[model samples]
Target: MIGLGELVNSEGEFGVDDYRACLAAKHANLERAIQEEWERPAPDQISLTALKRRRLKVKDEIVRLRTGKAIGRRLAAPA
Candidate 1:
């Protein structure tokens, strides 16, 4: 499992926008994997669930980085 620390550098080597873009790409790849798994004749529920969870985490991080909010903090409900 890839952690935020792995994608980010503590030495200030990379910027926040770069991390956001990486997370976005990772999220998109996870979505594609989920879709492909769904299309399989024998879909693996365990793998699909794991992928979805990771995707959610990446998405949460992306939102936090973009809006300067805490990670995993729920967004306001849309009207």
Candidate 2:
């Protein structure tokens, strides 16, 4: 699976700066989900496009969190 950076970079509609900025904002939103316990999100409350965007945001967050954990492990190892 493509990572969040790759996915955001692949967006043709946005320039690199805007894409990165948007992804950063989405990342923050996903982090908030972690704090909020995302289970109760109202599925029927949002438009289809918004729902799809949220799904992708969560997927990207998963990729980001896993990558961060791996990096942390590597950094923690004795050099």
Candidate 3:
């Protein structure tokens, strides 16, 4: 299964800048969706929760990529 973290360019290569840009666009769309949902008189909890979860996942991937770390890898911070 392809994951967002495994995104590739049209040339079939992973470009950090391109990936970041894509993530940014996705994040923006998610934010807009969340805002729209909130604007509704009767917001749906399920939809809001799903959107927020997806947004958070995208954010985490952006952070991980920016830090030059592979997705799903955890490194202990110095105490």
lDDT of each: 0.75, 0.49, 0.78
- List candidate 2 segments past 4 Å from native: 1-12, 38-79
Model 3 Cα lDDT, one tens digit per residue, 14-47:
6566567777889999999999999999999999
Query: Model 2 over residues 1-58: C-alpha lDDT tens digits?
Result: 2234443333233343344455566656655654455455653434444655775875
Error of 1 at 71 (Å): 12
Highest TM-score among the candidates is held by which one?
Answer: 3
**Predicted model with the maximum lDDT:** 3
Q: Please count the clashing residue pairs in each candidate, in the order shown.
A: 0, 0, 0
- Alpha-carbon TM-score of each model against the true structure: 0.70, 0.33, 0.73
Ranking by lDDT: 3, 1, 2
Model 1 lDDT vs. the true structure?
A: 0.75
**Candidate 2: Cα lDDT at 48:** 43
Instruction: State the lDDT at 47 in candidate 3.
Output: 100
